[model samples]
Target chain A: MPHDDHDHPHALLPPEPALRVKALETILTRKGLIDPAALDEIIDTYQNKIGPQNGARVVAKAWADPEFKDSLLNDATSVVAELGYYGRQGEHMVVVENTPGQHNMVVCTLCSCYPWPLLGIPPGWYKSDAYRARAVREPRKVLAEFGVTLPAETSVRVWDSTAEVRYLVLPMQPKGSEGFSEEELAALVTRDSMIGTGLPKVPS
Target chain B: MTRVHDMGGRFGDGPVNPESEDAPVFAEDWHARALAVTLAAGSLGQWNIDISRHARERLSPKDYTRFSYYEKWISALADLLVQSGVLTEEDLRGEADGGEHALANRALKAEAVAGVLASGGPADRPSNVPVEFEIGQEVVTARPAANRLVDGGHTRLPIYAAGARGRILMVHGTHVLPDSSAHRLGEAPEPLYAVAFPASELWANPEHPQDEVVLDLWQSYLEPE
Candidate 1:
């Protein structure tokens, strides 16, 4: 027999931000300007339907297929759309490849513009003042903080999301994974790796 | 002339703190609500995305820095709702009765969410003017007179990139000009390009000498160097 856990209680203890959201929702719903059901759909779409997994799958396919990789690097928007992933902030897609000589990183210094359909909502750190301010000036130093210390010889290329175009970094495939299947490679693709903040997991 | 939101190359922002690998998309339930509501209201067609971005940038410097990411979104959404005549402040404060709905028909429905998200609003508009610059051409971003801002309105050109010289990397097709579209003036499509600035050119003392920063700038923002 097991006892019920009491860590999370079913109470309406909303925080300040939560309270503000509740009030806003109430007014909007009353005015018939927004539908709560529709709001739920949007939340569910981002929370469950969309995420970095989509980008990881795209990366794995590129890694396993040479033609796909070429097409992705050349025409990223159409290539990703072929995978049934295209919309929202990811309408204009640009896939930047990371190599030993040139390391690619993406940042929206003016705002937090991310590829929502491919990478989902922008992460908290990506929207932070510190990352937005320092990434352009001291990318190598920022990478070091993220535990991604590149060689001093390798030049770091930072792409600012200044306009509608969104970027995704296709990280380098690890050594000794030549025989890995697409599914196996996808499993090794981490979210941060696609964001240029961290690398993919090494095959076990 | 520099807005508080343009935070590139600014100093004293402290160290970067990345969240854990397995962090959830929404840190709190309210964040999800905030994002969803904002997006839903935006689908009402009252204002464009650029207008919404301008609203966020319009926040005061103190409030902008103090508020959390979602806090900014929620706060801007409130102001936009009132400004667009979708709802009034009295309604928000529960001090007045809910009036007849004029924009109710435009409310996004749950069933249409997937399709709406899949078919995003594209900004690429055909341009009649010839592209003034080409790939590999050296160009410099427009710089207003000292202490003057660009139109004192919504602009994608950050302060750090202003007056900086860079080479054109790619010739992106004409897209809707945000500076005009934000003010509901017109799309005013123009040539967009990916400009690459060397670290030495963008900064006085470069941290990574070999590195470069790339930005997608409009034709109007660039001039022959």
Candidate 2:
């Protein structure tokens, strides 16, 4: 939608979004405004190194160690940084615990500000207009759409990430997860669970 | 003004199609490049992240909503590059040849990419200014005096939450306010708080009356209630 060529010298620029991107990159690279190799390196970092697994490990540790959980809830930035999960879009971290009576959810009403260090890149739905608008208005209905049905008595707490701080939802440990090891618990931590859109996977 | 990017409480957009947990970090190579370029250009230190965000938000409304997330990133990158004098219009149009100008001093290198991202810049700097609000303090959001609505500039205050009453849930330490930072008007660091407003208060005829919405609001956006 940003394709208004008001001052363009060439009106015949490519129409396809991807082609336009390629053209822009080619121009930037040719003009020495960007480095292709560095671009690849950045891509690799987000593609492989950073992701939900990092947050999953944090969640797993909290589920296993009460002391770690306390540290995570009190000062998540330091605790998460201890595990090498501190970076852009995650400078300030806050972990909200979800209890039986209260469920926690997160949404960025003004643009998509997510915890890239821990959760890697946010899901598409997290950036969708529908989720951004309706998450705060009808969180229950939104959660239900994600197949997360909670008890009527439970109150939902939706966190609108409006500032520099980023939030990670610490879902209630599922029943029967007591005997599971930390590694196993991490396996059950789904991306949606940490975002508060869905519950953590139960033993199945 | 309430930009298209500030989408809170408005509805009827469409259904949400969530990808699987293991979905790829980027849908295409261009997306990766877009992100990389944005980050690399940002490392030049000419502008901050908040400025970059404002660049994206300042796009035309049709462009703001029409551009896929990464497309927005690339568009913003181009805008920033041109505005910062790093690239000319001819350069973006692909009409200019290489060697026209010297590159920015802080251009990211391949070897330093991992190190740069791993040792990411944190925005939470301590402030000497005294905090204005405290946890559990009841406060009302500051509203535009005449119209009863907040508008204009790059503000973190969402339209829906403006002029609402809420209780401070937590007093997050002083940090850079995006509104001022986005305009290169200094950090303007202030005490930010996680304010909790009842869902019923934010919306009329709320579906979940007992539910609460917590928003991280800056001190400047609130008045003691």
Candidate 3:
């Protein structure tokens, strides 16, 4: 076949180039094709970098200091402001305190809306359509995957941030951190902890 | 129709539930991308610009594509600079003289000194450094923030936050915005504690019972609260 005029570099294929490529891969898979490891590597790189890592510092501070705790419970951004950090586009932040009985999970519902300054880039899953869609609908099912089995009696508030404010989950601090310093407490505050799907418990 | 991102249920939630990221994994090949970048960089002025414009016009139609936002910014800037008289191929490609790298550090340094100047700080202040604020200390969110908070006319507090009442939650030492950079390159000003807020305070919500939100509203955005 003769070379066509469309040979210019930097020319992008029509939209959904990624989707089209995946479709091709799917066809190949149905016919017993490519190894899945190729896909795994792709997911690994972005997934790790998506969000912030604040070990339960915010929660720990809240747990320890009655005043600061009140500030955090009242307003997370202001509490963060108390520490001197601020939000990006998703400014106005809310720290949703999760009790043993009630669990709260936040999704922007608008876009994969996020609190980037506090949390950093959201994990790949946070942005995925699946998380956005189902987190709103099946909060219990999704939380279960994260090893969070909630009591049926508890109120599950799934916040859908619209324009002004964004929500961050303040996970319950670990049991042994009674004497930990603020920095130590902060270390336990992962961005995931604030997101509510994950607990502040450190992995063994 | 609202964008799938808009999420107000214009169309039904559909088969692609928001929670479904398990399968149909995305494509992310760095080698392929690096190759694509090198090749695209090789492409000339109008062609790349046209391509970029077309892509932007169509919202970068390619899916499963992996280009970091910063990567694209640099590529587009480099392309435009090379294409225009601002830079030449000879400028990018230099004869190595008494150095390991082709470009000189002095030449790079000189680029930053190229243009623009406004003020060192706001009128009457020598350095636009911030006055340290204690937690819960009362302060008014500056009327415009530009006049009160910023020593220079540069600021980061959103236009919306001007004159909002808040207290000093923390004192973030002096930091500089690009506005400060372009204007006061040497003068980094004091960063103030931004007050976060409750959404209920800003918006009315019966569904949200006393549901408060927080904002790291800059010191500029707060008045004495």
Candidate 4:
């Protein structure tokens, strides 16, 4: 709850100095103050030590056993712990099931709220003003833009997340993953699949 | 119950800007210092507390938004120091000149990232003043009244969901309040609703009329359903 959202005393908010802001950030980078390579390190550290990779592990375990999967969907925190992604934010996560009849999309209309520990760095569009404003009005259209066109008959339910519950999509397992190891199956589970867009097609 | 970073379980569908964003611009002199301040404030925020209460606040609307993600943090730190009598501008300059700035505060800088503010959009731009409401309350979504645009003020309220209805799902924190982000906007908005919008209310003649979707709506953008 920021004061700025309602404190501006005008109609449509004032446009910010976008160009100026960009120029200044460039200067900060040149000053050698920020480790130019720090971003890559951050991404790598999270991807390897934390992030969606851990989430995939959870998904893989669930795919291999129905009991475990049910535990994951019903009580994600403890089940994920059994798989060993401890202390990360998913320690208390909730898995929202996406079945054939329905689809779920996540957005933070108020701000750029996200689950970074489980998902890694959020995509650029996740923080865009356009996506935030449009996701609410035209979710299906946005999903379609991401190449996640659903059957016309299915219902699209957009979940505008506040700071309440974090969401994860349980994508259907691919056909060829039957004999794959947990690591292999984990690889097949793309971040997009968990976001409820493209399904994990059976590995050819 | 959820933190800003734990967005996965809440949103039913795709991730919101599920990726990192390009650092927005800020004035050069203010960038690093502002980042320090914001980082200190963020560290406090990790516990869901506002540090502004204990610290002297010096951030202007322009400086707040102008700062990059980290820059806001630095400025927040500096402001806190001055306010709390821990350090002064002269001390900061002396430390910088004596080469003790970074070395004396590496741990502090490391901890600066803890509770970054989730405030989106440019900090300088005017924000919407969310109308008052509670979660689960019914509301109607409508476009902004065309005539409210006046003088230099800005509104965070977007005109996208004109003539829509929803239920109050959340009451977020208050920041720079926008006087108008909706049609028939009241003077101020509080408790912005993280609402669910049916796909039908958004698009015309949806294949499934019963299917619904939810979106966050500022109190200003809605009316009683």
Residue B174 C-alpha lDDT in model 2: 89
CA lDDT, candidate 1, residue B35: 97
Q: Clashes in model 1: which pairs?
A: none
Best first by DockQ, ranked: 2, 1, 4, 3
Deviation (Å) of A132 in candidate 1: 0.5
Residue B201 miss distance in model 4 (angstroms): 4.9
Badly placed stretches (over 4 Å) of model 4 are A1-44, A86-92, B1-41, B44-197, B201-208, B214-225
**What tens-digit string does per-residue lDDT give for candidate 1 at A1-204?**
001121111011133778878888877788787899999999999999999999999999999999999999999999999999999998899999999999999999989999998889988999999999989989988988999999888898899999999999999998877978999999999888998989999977
Give the per-residue lDDT of model 3 (tens digit) for A1-204: 011232212232212334423333332223222223333432342244323543245566786787887778776755675554453323456677777666677765434457654564455567545565556555566677666776656656666553235667777768887877877777766555578776675623
Tell me how each candidate scores on DockQ against the true complex: 0.39, 0.59, 0.08, 0.16
Better by TM-score, candidate 4 or 1: 1
Off by over 4 Å in 2: A1-13, B145-151
Please estimate how well model 2 matches the true structure, expressed as its whole-model Cα lDDT. 0.82
- Between prediction 1 and prediction 3, the one with superior TM-score is 1
Mind giving the per-residue lDDT tens digits that candidate 4 earns over A1-204?
224333311111112323332333233333333332333333334434545676677778778888888878767755665665444233235576677787776676645545555675455466554566566566666776676788776676766653234567787787768978888888887776776644664677
Give the least accurate 10-residue stretch of model 4 chain B, judged by summed lDDT.
B115-124
- Give TM-scores of the second chain, every candidate: 0.95, 0.92, 0.41, 0.36
What shift in Å separates residue A48 of candidate 4 from its native position after superposition?
3.8
> Which candidate leads in DockQ?
2
lDDT for residue A127 in candidate 1, whole number 0-100: 97
Clashes of each: 0, 2, 46, 104
TM-score for chain A in each prediction: 0.91, 0.93, 0.69, 0.72
Residue A203 accuracy (lDDT) in model 2: 91
By lDDT, the best candidate is: 1
Model 2 Cα lDDT, one tens digit per residue, B180-212: 787777787878899999988889867766799
Query: lDDT by residue for model 1 over B1-225, one digit each (tens)?
Result: 557899999999989999986899999999999999999989999999988998787666775898899988888777677666666666766776776478889889999999999999888888996899988999999885122223567788788888899999988899998888877788889999999999888888888789999999998888899
